[model samples]
Target: MTSFSYGEFAYVYDELMKDVPYDRWVEYAARKLQENGLSAPSILDIGCGTGEVSVRLAKAGYDVTGVDLSDDMLTVAQDKAQGEGVQLSLFQQDMSQLELPSSFDCAVIFCDSLNYLETEDQVKGTFKSVYDHLEPGGLLLFDVHSLYKVNHVFGENTFTYNEEELSYIWSCFQGEHPNSVEHDLTFFVYDERKDAYDRFDELHKQRTYSVDTYKQWLTEAGFSKVETTADFTSDSPTDKAERILFCVQK
Candidate 1:
């Protein structure tokens, strides 16, 4: 299997995700804060890959600090923030052992980044870290892939994307654990000068636990309240929902 690297992939991350509903994600955070009767002037964004949502939130007039494990990805995020004339504080840190100099009114782990933690302990550690960094009665928001999506939707599936400048073939295989999957991705990028395609590959793995497990971990991490919604909607999840969003308070 090819090794995992985002150095090359980070350059095209925004182009590939141009269709993602980032504005909705920002609005969701705002609505959740309003629902809890909390005012949010500062936020901590954990696992903030490429800073798409982080930049959006900053533009919405919030003080945003972003953290991610990938320096390559953080480089892209910094460039985007500069181009938009928005200031963002970014750090390269592992979410599982997060550390920051300050606390905030809200913290978020959106875009299913939690799935990258392969073990329960890692996830719980991340929750505890977030709890430690939050002000009293602060809020935490996150989303993860539902068990149905991992076990069925991505089970041994092969998908392809083709475009004028780039193309890719992605294959997914079951991992060693339940609700886990490994992704093997091959990319071909057009070289305009040479009139040829340059190829690169990346491998990634993700795991998700049951909703009950997540709730238990949040409680153990000292979150006072935890509620869940499905697929960006303010409703309880059904068995077939692909993603689950969590709203918790410290």
Candidate 2:
């Protein structure tokens, strides 16, 4: 299995992502729903890590269901829903082989989680599975790291972040395939009771295809009206854009 499993990372995810603009992601989804004339939508949140966006959407009055491959992540997400006083239907399942009893009006794979699929077939399979779980005319929204970022930006890069209680050294290496990268991350976290720092290491791989390739796969998976944007904007992606967003309708 790929190291994409959250594992120990789940406990510290929100702490590291405290500055993430989850509200903007929710706003983007809401905009798409209104533009498509969808009302009172039921949402399916694929790869809903830690239930942050899931709970946010539920609070926004959408009936929300979340799914993730990591049991640890789902456990945190379930607790988060309870803490927020919102109801969420959550499950543990692989997105590529998703099986759900009910269909949804809209589905989302946000935060560039789709890039975690290492192969073209896996990406297409996930799209197909999502299509099967959606109603006709349903929408699917997702994002991926742009090819430029994968090939030029992340390739052979090193980043470090330091805080009082948590720190990490992140290194990236070029992958065997085009527009792919492997991440090597080591985290040092303060143990309050023991008053010492504990170290944890995690390796993750991510790959992304061209925008045209993504559109083609979505079409092959029975989606129509597939459109794309860049980095949360309504404009097309440019050479420097780091993220690409896709909106597809089934």
Candidate 3:
């Protein structure tokens, strides 16, 4: 029941996720574009948490529009874009139901945001909404946590890490059903400058569906040529893969 409120940790999200190799993912997408002869003047980044990837794409000379449901997260993104002088258009919106001025040339939903949708209707609705907001022949790339990884690695994982100033307790519990994992995350942050301490607890739930189910949903949502791969490379998904990235065309 601990939805992403982002009260105190909103300012620290980018700092924590900076280690994520988002540039690598962008490179993968760019290579896919080059190989497939896909060129888009503009792109819509759905579920763009803090707009890190969108900002990178902007550095590569693309008009990027980042959208997310959290206003706190969007504020951080706006600040970063202003500070870095990146011309990004960020909006507070939901992926399952979006209202935009016009369709985009391409849309990206990265960082496993698709897993945040807890229900089947939400996933199908999001895909259908994306299809409606894309131009013909446009591309859509997204990633999801793999069921295999959820069942094996994250099912019963628990660990603790303590840095010079801050400490954290991270645990994962198997969720109800065929494809779900619950993250029991607790952060004990220390402000060295003020010798103060604060704590934050978050319970995150993520799920993955079969590739066939996703393809069916994409096809029903008007997407054609739905394909999935392991990691960012063009490889088949396996039991040990962390995430399954889906590449679909409008």
User: Which sequence of candidate numbers ranks them by lDDT, best first?
Assistant: 2, 1, 3
Supply every candidate's count of residue pairs whose N, Cα or C atoms clash at under 3 angstroms.
Answer: 0, 0, 0
TM-score of each model, in listed order: 0.96, 0.96, 0.93
Candidate 3, residue 157: how far the Cα is off, in Å: 0.6
Q: Candidate 3: where is the Cα deviation over 4 Å?
A: 1-4, 192-194
Best by lDDT: 2
lDDT of 2: 0.91
Residue pairs clashing in model 3 are none
List CA RMSD, all candidates: 1.4, 2.2, 2.2
Tens digits of per-residue lDDT for model 2 on 162-183?
9999998999999878889999
Tens-place lDDT per residue, model 1, 1-250, is 3343698889977777888888877889999988887764689999899999999999988899999999999999999999999999999999989878999899999988999988888999999999999999899999999999999999999999899998889999999888899988898888899998888888888999899999999999999899999998988999999999999999
- Could you tell me the lDDT of residue 176 within candidate 3? 75
lDDT by residue (1-250, candidate 3, tens digit) is: 2233575567767656767989977987787666667665588999988878988888888889999988988888888888889988888998999898888878889998989888899999999999999888888888888877778878799978777656678899987756898888887777778797667788888888887899899999988787788977789888788889888888
Return the lDDT, model 3, position 221.
94
